[model samples]
Target: MLELDEKFFSRFGAEYSPNEIIFCEYEPGYEFYFIQKGRVRIVKIINDMEKTIDVLGPGDVFGEMAILEEQPRSATAIAMDSVRVLKFHRDNFDALLQGNPQLAYKLLLIFSKRIYDAKRRLMILLLEEPNVKVMDVLIMLAEQNQQFDFESEITLNTTVRQVASWAGMAESEAQKELTHLARLDKIELYEDRIVVKNIRDFQRIVASRRKNLYSS
Candidate 1:
């Protein structure tokens, strides 16, 4: 999906099954990858629970930060589906980029967007309300995945416990807000997923709470 040159397909392409571990956190960073198909989940252990911080689709890049900093991986990458990716090793990465100007520009654009996204997530963490944090985390994921819509139902492949971990709150607190949202028909909770009745429904509540954060 990245419009990568066919020259690398045969030489560097790799395939993975669903639930396969691409790399683990703190491991040596030998290479980075760009998704060619399906999805990859970027996870980290937060409050002793594994949480999906980012879900990457085709054309996305992961494991680059480690390569850049010459350090261990910051998070774990897992295949969420039968996925295909093009792997780039650190040794040859410079040569490849020097020869492929177009590829370098494309990757620069993506890295810029990732930085902006990180800033927005930091703002979400600044909010004091546990409930708003939960809703904002959902909003953040939906927005990142480009799946948010006011009139359409979207099922987030996440559970209350995962949400709590991402939001840095207790699981019980996240579940309570989820149940309240379900009572209002804003969301439908399942064992492993939460179907957002309308993405904008949660958006409105999150915005309103932020507005009243300094109010009496």
Candidate 2:
């Protein structure tokens, strides 16, 4: 979580529930938020279809880009579950950052990482095969939401539609590829989740896909 002065939160703390819209794409952004709990999905409407670009959990921040750039929002922020957030008006945010150098540095690091991840996803989308694209997205999600357990499996707390959206493919196509991978014993798919049996093997598959992309 961001280390803000108590005065900041006393004025800005707010709560939201699942399916709530925090902000809409292209709308003017007045405030930015830091998640205190739960998750939020960053989505964009492409060709009239909503595509989820990223999921954020506790300690994550959103809406700052628009504030910093002084432009309309680039994407829509929707609550994924019960969420608590600290909202800061543009002036308050600037003041907070000025007072807390460490927080500002942390925000810079987060933005840098997001940019790098976006570039990587773009590269993955350029791959030719839908199967490869699906596998790449699965691996990426697994890495982002890694689960440490005695069983050595990584579980994705996401749905097929979101995965398909990330892969730039239809749900049916993503489901088919996922089922094929499951049949090959590469992963275990449940009604609401997916489990990668071995993280090492998952990485190997992703690496092979990259190799094939280059080799071809």
Best by TM-score: 2
- Candidate 1 lDDT tens digits, 97-179: 88777778878898898788778777577778877787888887677676456579888888887787667677898899889
lDDT of 2 by residue, 75-173 (tens): 999999998898878877778777778778878988898897888689769878888788788777766753554258778777888778878888899
User: How high is the CA lDDT of each candidate model?
Assistant: 0.83, 0.82
Which predicted model would earn the best lDDT?
Answer: 1
Error of 2 at 84 (Å): 5.6
After superposing candidate 2 on the true structure, give the runs of residues whose Cα lies further than 4 Å from its correct spot: 3-6, 10-20, 36-41, 50-58, 79-85, 89-94, 145-154, 197-205, 212-216
Q: What is the lDDT of residue 35 in candidate 1?
A: 92
Give the per-residue Cα lDDT of candidate 2 at 147: 52
Clash pairs (backbone) in predicted model 1: none
TM-scores for every predicted model: 0.69, 0.74
